[model samples]
Target: MMKWACHRPLALVLGMAGLAFGAPGAEATESGASLYLLGSGGPGTAVMPPLEGLYFDKMVWVYDGSAEANRRIPVNGNITLGLDTTIVADFTTLLAVPSTNFLGGTLAVGVTMPLGAPIIDAEGLLTGPAGGTTLTGSLHDSALTTGDPVVLTQLGWQADKLHIQLSTMTNVPIGHYRESGLANLSLHRWAVDGSLALSWHDPESGWDISAKAGYTANGDNRDSGYDSGDEIHIEGAIEKALSPKFSLGIQGYYQKQVSDDRGMLGPFRGEVVAVGATAATTVMMAGVPATFRGRIMEEIDTTNRLEGTSFWLDFTVPIHMNMPAG
Candidate 1:
């Protein structure tokens, strides 16, 4: 069953009993909307890592890069699309607002933009009526390159050793997309998501853990006449601080369709699970504090979705990290 996944697209023409029929469920997986589910639990997940109340008067810049690869993805009974050129490079900028009356917390405003795509290669085996075929090819298509831009707004509350937040992410559909394209980076529809996140810290041992859960409400793709499904995603991480400037941890995420995919074909579901390790460190440049984080993840299980590995490097630098201490 080829579900139009980012990792698989049965482009081959397979037949049963002399009847030519492409694979079933040849729908496009939620590549455009699925990017939001990559979050992993870690410190300050409940809020922008460096844009919390205590960090007021500061702005942060973040860069993320990731790639996914899958071998022999089934497209149909006789065809397959191999995925190799999957990569996403994203940039985000965030600013922290001072304390507010609501939840006695702070507000964070940010914008995240991604420049990349999902499908990179394709190989196929076409079975004809004569039952003889050997086929192969490669493709490089980046879904993220045409995907919409995301806006983030969240309220964060920090108390002693506890941190909590409520956030919303909105994706604007105004990127490159073709209704019939084998692979695309744009959803061509709006997606609004809400999330709750939490972080706990132990001052003495410098141990910490965090988690974030979110739900997505998607809109219809006018061009394709298809409505992607609502989705649920969870991200979490465990970490230990080696020093005030360094930390190491494990992080991961899981995502699944909550509502059946709507439109044209009507209602199909998809799911995926992934896990990875994380490492981070802080450096001072010209009296400014900067943070660098790197993570690698492996997709363990998936249904009607992409199956592959992913990794990213994140760098954050606060604009006012050089400000004088009180």
Candidate 2:
């Protein structure tokens, strides 16, 4: 059996958590948000634990970006231009892997809950009561709120130096939401995502390469009468461990909308590409082994969305380990 880091299961759960909530974007969906957060999956995307156990993971994400002055963004039943946004959020995830196997693979289930606040500032042109009269105004909104929860299930298999996993995630739209609230945290709609991940790790050489691809299908928001289109995302990472406790890597992601969104000013489709650097290390926490990882990314290219930078910090710890009897 191949041995992964102590919290490989936790890393797997964290990747799925990115599929659960809406992330601030230029104008991907209603209010310039999307269900899938880009660049969420980095290294160790398909790695699973050799032993069955329970694990916990937490991630903090920060983003700052803005749309072009010519772009029109729909928010709170109004069209806005020169839109700028900032977001700070955290995701808490818990995962459980049983000793039992399904089809020669380990089966795991997990859940993630998110809490965040988004700040939005925009300038808009409004028509006055008088004909052909235009008024320019600015609006700013910010509030702390809770986001929708996500549930995940996956089956993983390891073959010598290679690992593969199949996973599915669902969004539960029961978080803080308001159709007219510019700073709301929830999308107020259901969504589902299916993904496949692959990893190649050489224990002797300390090299790891991983990739993940997923598709998201979104449902309509009845309150806003908006229907977001389907989307696809791909993420990849290449890492080399310099020492047992530390490693450095490069990661990137590509995201694009595959369908057209309804109830928008026009046929709104979003696309973006981002690349970044990542680092990871292992440490002991209260006598338990834990893993810490950080990443910073910048959007080099974008269309119909905001172009900005994002930072991520993640922590993973195994709560319990169930070793098989000899």
**TM-score against truth, every candidate:** 0.73, 0.90
Q: Pick the candidate with the highest TM-score.
A: 2
What is the TM-score (0 to 1) of candidate 2?
0.90
What lDDT does candidate 1 reach at residue 221? Answer: 67
Q: What's model 1's overall lDDT? A: 0.51
Q: Write candidate 1's Cα lDDT for 161-223 as tens digits.
A: 677878777777776665544444455678788888787866467677788888878787666
Candidate 2 lDDT score relative to the true structure:
0.73
lDDT of candidate 2 over 1-326, digit per residue (tens): 22255214254432222211122322566665666667766777888766688878888888888776666665544566777788888888888888537889988888888788788887754432321146568878888888788888888998998989898888888988866667766767898888998989777788889999999888888886678788898999998888878888999999888988776454578788899998888887777678888889998988777788888888888788786787
Highest lDDT against the true fold, candidate = 2
